[model samples]
Target chain A: MIDSIQIRDFRGIRWGEVDGFKQLNLLVGPNNSGKSTLLEAIYLGCTAGQPAHWEGDSFEPAQVSLSGRDFLGDLPLLRVLKRHRYHLRKAGQGPYRDGCLNISISSPAAPLRRFQLHVPDLPILPDSLRDMDSKISRIEIDEGAQVALFACASGRDAGRAERALAGRILQLLSPTQGAGSTRQKTVQSGHKTPSGPNKQRRTAQRGARPSSGTAGPGQQTAIPRRPPAAQHCIYLWYPDLTYHSAGVAAWSLTGKLASPEHVLFFDVSNTHYHFYKTFLRDTMTRVPGWTYKIADCLREVLGIARSFDFHVQFLPAKDNDSLIQGWIAPRDQPALPIDAYGDGTRTALKILASLLSLVEQATADSPAVLLWEEPELFQNPRMLNRLLREIARLIEGKPLQLFMTTHSLEVVACVAMLVREGLLPADSLRAFRFSLEEGTLRSSWFHADNLLSWLERGMDPRIWDTLGVPLQFTLKEQEEGAE
Target chain B: MSAAMGGSIDAFYEGMTEKKILHMLMQRGLLAKVNLCDGKETGKTEVNRRLRDVVGPNVGTKQVRCLVLRDLDERETMERIKQGLQTALQALYRERGHPKAVVRFVRHRAHGNVYLHTCTELDVRVALHIATYRHLPDFCKSTIDDYVLRVALHHETAAALIKRQGWSISSKRIIHKVTSEIPALLKQNGIPMMGEAKDFIHFYAALLRVHTSPAVFAEKILHHAPESELREVFAPLRAAAEFLQDASSPSMPGDRLPA
Candidate 1:
């Protein structure tokens, strides 16, 4: 688990720092309090090494380039060689000097890596000045050490360095997090490159003598490779009026729709009413004419009640395009010819399908984390409450870790109701208050009760009138006295 | 003179007869003295005895020591009876929390002189008198200027005040002379006559009352000014009154002006 993160001179933060997290962490603060910024920072740092298929496509080595001048500014030899002027002035030991980024990380379950990237400031040169031979700079993890990878026009040391660097980075990526405690071996065993093309000439150039221990044969070396674990992120927001009263269902099912590897996807436009129907159907036996079982596993997971095995047909995306194309479930569902249903059926089907999918996942050992934003859209208050309760019921039976974000009092109230009914762990439930302080994003975490109180005092008072809910407390003392 | 019985109107007129009874009662050295008539008609003797019993020491009375009845003509008596009852009740109040009561009454003419001829002790009389005066403070800070200003502002009628103060000069002449010298009065006090004339009169009258009797003060200063001039001179006072009215009146901001 990543413990703490400190950032400086990055976007939206000067001296930003935040810490304290558990298995299921939450970020909440006022708008522009940098909650999202913090999440992005973690995403960037972990982007370093994710390539293997077992780890999934999420952790591929995306390209991010740094210019050659940064190295000239960071290294001591380049400083004197280039006679960079800006470095001298900003050499002071303050946080935001000319060039310094010392990042420290600690993870007991994973390897601890420190990345200190710096840039040196160069003197201003005339506009016309240009160097034809100057090369674009690159940084690479080489033989367990950070080495400057340069691409010269001449391509002199390119071939050897490329092979060595690629091998080293690959090794760095392949280490298992926890192997039987025999001290797994490092990927690089002091690999050195020949300075000159002639092997004897390179040996003569470096007169070194240090006896090094050799690795026993058939010993498993620990490569720095772990499946880029599903990056659990919950992006919650109070949707616009268009999405108000919209029931949201999203999960990544890792398999084909028909095969055992298949996972279901259901998107509902208005989830409020449908959630109740699905919830009742799941908990209670339906009457003979009202319900039928779909032997097709995918259809069942999708919560499509089928009258007969042959009658089971995949519905077209016409009715479910927006509903199915939600956050988590990748949009690959084959479209069938079906008219867009009215809002009531569309919304109900969307929520029912999502709940059905959740019921399927809950049957499994590991359930996908649900990310929902503003599920209280377009529905009456009663519908909103029912949707929340159904969501809670689905969550209660399922092993899935649920993460939802909302600004609606009814939505929060529903979750609180779940908390009140012992459907979810009170402590497990977290509400984050996101706000801006000192031009940086800051957030405070709260449990269900705290979230409820904050909603009542901070949000409900301001928006209650708009919601048509009777003002629980008067807005002004004078009004209260008059009442 | 015939031996007149006490409590009868006849005995009151026959002063020597009542005085003889009083002297005899004093000589006899009774705890309480009473002159009585036989209970043949209206019980004049019984009334006297009852009065003695009410006033007598060790007779259910906790504090009262003496009582004085200043009767007057019927109209005056009725007015004074209310005034006297109110005044006595006020005197009995324990404003300081300590359980002590002293009842006294003052006739209308006794300006600045409160009669505390009660059955209470001398020290009690002095303390109660001081406390009564202390309760009439115009401000937290005690000053002659403040006292004068307070008196001028609160006292309603100049003629009444003059008559009540028992001023020697005719109220009209005093008022006329003070009115004529209004400019000099303002100049003497180093106060500008920027406000209404009534304001000036009140302010000046208050100053005058501090050093002189209220009657002299009012007659000499207040009555000379006409109502219009008084209103003009008391411009600041008018402003203060306007402010008080605005603060008290109930009207919302959006109310339309009357056509």
Candidate 2:
């Protein structure tokens, strides 16, 4: 169990300390209480070894950078970028407060090892806002002799950049040697050598086509990235703008069949809802150890599963713009792709698949760490409950640890139930109530007993409304006057 | 008779040893409560036939005296005592003139039973005894019983203290001069005897008195003497008493009167 966490000058928090985390930790805090900031900090710390500044030049839509003005112009992208900026600043503070994330992890008999994940700020340029033509800057992991893994990216999509880096770090801790990767060869034969006539005719026709040295790499020819021996850490997000049809198609085709070692990342601004569904479906099917039971629970409760392969597309964005999309399954299934299922079912499926993939990837030899932002997005109480219940079950009897940021009480309640049922050891479950107290993010752990008691008495619903505010207020009013 | 009949020849020869001959004679003397004496001056040859049986070889006479006193002066003042042999010898002779003063043992039974002096002095100025009561009335059985009790308590207390402290003092070594030994060591020189409970009250009050009036008792006893002595010497007793009282008190305020 990690004994405690002390953060300094990271996001909304100037300095915050929390002690007593068992194997499982649930952080509860107000929206701005730096709950997500804390998770991002851990991700950064774990993957802080590599330099972010790398070589890549691809002008993609997701890479199109915008200024504070242009970024603000698009409310959805602006909000997304704002959160990224906060993380960047936090990860960059060096002397007085290096924008860095520090993590402390421990085993039963081992001492705590403090690690720092450092990343330099890589701002997207206005010209590259529409086409993501940026690259990673610098990543420094384990700066102080502490164990850390770092990755750097210069992509227009900071979310993908971070996820790619996180995946690299997780690969170091638990290397998955053999499940999803395989090698194969092809053999061709001809009767009587087909020799004279057919062989020469084919050669002569090929030679007549003109020698233009312009052949691109094909899907079948492209060499796959060998699975990293170590376990993986996944970073994911959804499309912020633009149509996601093409991205969604690519996701189900080759992406689904790739090694599970490839951490799932959703740059929503450049991804369609179908991509999420396909990813979920593929993760559920392809991963060696994910299950539909968790999915069923989610569906029964939430009435939705985002990636159940229901073939439904074109979810309305915050700006009221519809991202055109579609879902296609193999001919064997025949019916509309599973993505066609209702939005709720598809959403639930996506959440369950993501959780299960992480769980499956997390074997004893290579356990994984999963991070998710706003897990409660488009989720109702039942769905949220099912999702949390599934997550607890995933880590229930495994070596995997999960970190997530949520603004839903239902999610918190589910976690509390898991803790109460003894599914999670006292030290395993942790929650932080977060809020901006006096212009700064203040955080404290929510004791399970105290939280249940508070819930039993029926807390104000507003705590769920302003994710950061209500939690902060409740925690402050309750914890500040401690006897 | 068995030896005369020759059934056991060893029995006939047993009287040849000095110890056996002396034992046989002592058994015949019936020395149950009486002091025994040996005839050391008798002719060795004339008594040869039964010399070993009539008187053992070693013979000596030691004088012993039993003197009794009472605290009759009633002064509460310190009484000066001194040993004078002439006065003690005359008193003993007057009390038991018919007996020779061979082995003299001086046993005093005043405030309590105790062995008085090892030997009485020859000076006639000695009173040979002191008094709190008028006279040594008759040597009644009740007085003896009281003496035994006094001796037992003193011996027991000393033995207990030695056992408790794991000290080396033997109970036999502590000769009780009077029943007033413990109290006298705790209070001033001429202080009167106060009962156990009254003694504690007086001791506590003396502590209060020392702080209040330091000059009143300075002539005979220092103002701080009683309090200091009581506090230091009786500390264990005082602590035990306090503990007992506290344990007996009811904790609830309203339940003080058993309502």
Q: Candidate 2 i-RMS (Å)?
A: 49.9
Tens-digit per-residue lDDT, A1-483, candidate 1:
233343322234322434333222345433445554454333322221111100001211111111111100122112221221111111111232233222222212112122222322212221111121132122211111121111100011212322222222222222221211123232212112211212111111000111111221221342222212111111111011001211110011111011111112121323321122223343234222211221232233334436323222232223322122211111254432122334433443355444445445343433333434445545556655655555565556454444344545566566666776787777666554444434333333445544444333333311211234464422321111110
Question: Which stretches in model 1 have alpha-carbon errors above 4 Å?
Answer: A1-50, A53-313, A318-348, A362-365, A437-439, A452-483, B1-259
lDDT of 2 by residue, A34-113 (tens): 67656644444232222222111121111111111110112222234333642111221123123233333221111112
Backbone clash total for model 1 is 46
TM-score of each model, paired residue for residue: 0.29, 0.33
Tell me the deviation in Å of residue A185 in model 2.
60
Give a tens-digit lDDT track for model 2, residues B191-233: 6554332233224224323222111212112111233332332
Runs of candidate 2 exceeding 4 Å displacement: A1-4, A49-286, A289-343, A422-427, A438-441, A459-483, B1-259
Docking quality band of candidate 1, CAPRI definitions: incorrect
